[model samples]
Target: MRRSTRLSLALVLTAAAALAFGCGQQGRLTSPNDHASALSARPAFDPSSVRVVAAMASQDRATPALLALSGVVGTGTSIDAAGDPVIVVYTERARVANLPEAIDGVPTTVVVSGTVVPYARPGGGPLQMGTSTGNDLECAAGTLGCVVVKGGVDYFLSNNHVFARENAASLGERIDAPGRYDAHPICNQTPQCANLSQFQAVSFSSNNTVDCAIARPISGLNYSAAEAGGYTPASTTVAAAVGLAVKKTGRTSGLTHGTIEAINVTIRVQYTDGIATFVNQIQTPGNFIRSGDSGSLMVTETGNNPVGLCFAGGSGASFANPIGPVLQALGVAIK
Candidate 1:
């Protein structure tokens, strides 16, 4: 509905569930047992041998940060060691105030809403999916997704657009971080359409002007396996060397490859269907993003080190906000 940053909003969370969808941040809920149960219902993928990728919230778990946010948001090796998601919770949460006791899943988040603290990237870093189901939600309330681990509780993550109309994410909203839209017959806008579809809103994510939101999946849903898909992880090395080959994967365009046209260059972007535009903002070209490619992870070809994440693209070109901003905004690490 509106625009916001995923990480920045997550920084001020707890009670966002009711405020979600501009209906007063009433979040969703599920049981740990339900997560396990979902696994049986979850689609399968090749965890041992697979290419990795990343996204705000999807069913595919072949790449790192599988439907989950990084503890320290940055380029990390996509691996298949965990499932479920990383949750961000405030100690003073209102409804799910005592959320922990009521929740299951591991690699949890318990930072305060207004507290500005330096967070340490957990040992698990960003996750790579072992299983997948590539589902997503548009922008709604009460919907969420979760990231499941091998033996841990799942966390939540969502789009900033979902909570764009709210002051901040509320506490105690039962949601599936990185959710898939599930068609509901009762509330079916379309007989075959899902209420929220496969996408879930577990955490606070963004499409912010300065920052993109990304958070841990906190409840319900299962995020078993890590990220996996048809894309390759961009291996990279330090020093943004020129002529480096890179690639990207997005919801619209599958996988596209390009070179580091230039780093630290200015670019322009479109926020809405309006005729206005944002000009010459800092940008990177390693991964040129087209429409619907915002938040696409851009990596270097050398060692797969993350170089940038897609922000915008135009005039036969693309732009990104560098992985550094994602890390700074999320208070996490790269690995």
Candidate 2:
């Protein structure tokens, strides 16, 4: 007989954490026969150009001072309407007085984004990507970004907070599909839920570039790379560039589209355990993600090539780790 356990409301309430923060079945993974391929053309803006690199350097140098300013939250590189590289400063309020118009000869702009927080509001099949998932020990939930292959083994991809409990989970910990919050009373006790085991997760105790983790599937259960809404991400990864159109499918926000607002970003994100700083990240404006949407993969809208791994967000902005760094950090390739 299957054991059933009812979760208490307090456990659910305690699960609230930053968005930057998921399991299934003995079923073979299935994907569409025709998966999306990378776009044949390159973006107009060359992020590797000298001008863009100089602007990125300027942003990096000024980040310390800018983050110290009142209302300032983060800083990054962006492209202005004139198609020139510029420095972007993010603030909690509408404006921060006395911010410079330019940094090291590069132009500057300000964006009113509230305090950035991890989106961990915290999902089935051979469980699909971009669905609800979470640690079985807690009531919180978050999105399972996608699948990656390492050493010929398949693993589920998502933020550390979602699978590792912000570095609190041990290796081989159980992860539940639909997360505890989404599962509610039944939680991880249902046959429909797929259970996964923790594999690799970056520790939050040190400075990290990506808030990412990978979980191995229990025997018999499998996962598919196909995201919700039928979007298929390419196996290759691309660097983020300002003005690049992108889209993501997540647990909270389904499939939402937005343009790359900034890149080479340096920002501090509030997690359940503490504040952590991430450098060289990707930023998007408006409602790209909401609570429980962290871990959604940000891919190029045109060809669905992977670009960034969604993690944190603030009032007018959402943030992600560049896919290259995320993959390198976890030593995995997109499946």
Candidate 3:
């Protein structure tokens, strides 16, 4: 069924501490095991004190802080918690109805776009854009080369189609983000041992009903990319409109833009496998996204709040699943 109908919608930390115990217990003066308890009681920062990096975007609206690197940053909220990295739209921007508020008092500046991998499987693998088998796939076609999200457990969010041609259930292997400018590949080839350095999905799902997937990374592994001078997901509701200009960050296109032509247009997309498809969508008449641009974040001009996830676009049209529904499905808040 080829139709042009429309409607629209749509971690962790680990540290190693060296403990020094005096060789002679009688000679050493030490407190009891209460040290662990005290550490828990006295965290370095209050719940709200976790510092977040806020960057300024140029009139072009692209924030230097986020755009400095080739990655994703859509208008998102940190609804999960201030302490855990930031939370963003499941497939939408800054704010969704009833989602939590922005991290209390963080300063925000104008952003042309925020990079994102906006869609994920129900389990949490990212909806990425890449060939099932082909090129090195180093540079992406959009503003955001990649993105990070949280599912509260070992799972991280992503799109399953990134691994097309290969059987999803069969290709149970997970992918680690290829490091910048060549440090080392996250996952080694079949022969080598598992590298503890990068992210990986335990499994994936892209059946006829859903287009997303979840990959469980090492426990206590944070998908948050802010530490690398990039932006992560956060929730903040922003108003959207038809004809309102917007921008996006994705894996393929670093930073691009267009206007909202329509909203609430229902449509269908055949997942790469061709056996499964997704129905019901929010459509945009912009070419901000393309094939390799699968999991991009679509955002408003000023506040950088993401309005939708960039799926497929052609004929001067784009499609997205409202962030609101995505979160509800995931049962987590973005703000």
Candidate 4:
């Protein structure tokens, strides 16, 4: 079943001015040649090479202004056909004009990305990763990204908006599986939705870097780390980089695969409370996720190593928080 909490694309762009997480405040971009000059010779086009890093820096520097543009929504670093690094700009409509061909010697590419918003409302059955879950106070739901271990206790992982009500939920608030939206007519009646979880922690501060939260399962709740589709993610995590092949199993979209289109992304996401700017994020082309897919865990296609936590999306792209920082911020490790 679908929920009607989807945020409009126009609302997301309008809220961009209220930057959260220090978006667009990083230092200015430097010349590409200067950045390359500092690194020792390496194979040309190495994704981690100096040129790519320089382009990322340039992207960070240019994000603020680009986001301010009429149709622009976000920006990130990418590689061009020649293997040279370029800055990628995400927009809400067709290509935005007047965007400079290059920024600080780094080329730029504009991609149409509609309006990106948090995926909420949309899961059932056993308490499992990638299934539907959410706080009991709302009629909505979102994907349970994965399982995690914190302080030796196992917990359910997902976006803050899913488990903590975007920082409005009190500690110990009840969380339900199949979410109220999925539970439908029975959710508010007898044999009400199962209360298998409780809010443990959520980080949604002004300087936050992740849109994540963890919940402790009530005693005796049956749960598993395996996602919907029997895809078990590795306990180990990997850093996100451009071109990495990744996959995720979510509530709305069962299982989907896509390439990491960009890295070190800075984008604005529209939430129930307001807009939030996320930096150092990972990006992938659209179709990887959809409404109700928030909280899906993005992992390497081959190794199943966790790389990012799916959160927001737009017309042509989706965004995630790098798993490294997410785990660190929550003081947890993949289970």
Off by over 4 Å in 3: 1-151, 163-167, 170-172, 179-210, 219-233, 238-240, 275-280
lDDT of 2 by residue, 116-225 (tens): 42222210135678888877766667888888889998888888778877777777778777776764233422222334444334444566688888888777875578
lDDT of 1 by residue, 230-273 (tens): 43333232444456676554433535667766665633334443
What stretches of model 4 exceed 4 Å from their correct place? 1-126, 186-207
Which digits, one per residue and each the tens of the lDDT, describe model 3 over residues 177-212? Answer: 431111111111111111221222212233222233
lDDT of 1 at 28: 20
* Residue 26, candidate 3: alpha-carbon lDDT: 11
lDDT of 4: 0.70
RMSD of each: 18.9, 23.4, 21.7, 21.0
Candidate 4 lDDT over residue span 59-123, tens digit each: 66677788788888667665555666767666667757778899999877665645542222112
Q: Backbone collision count in every prediction?
A: 119, 21, 74, 3
Each model's C-alpha lDDT?
Answer: 0.32, 0.70, 0.35, 0.70
Error of 4 at 68 (Å): 62
RMSD of 3: 21.7
Cα TM-score per model: 0.40, 0.61, 0.42, 0.60
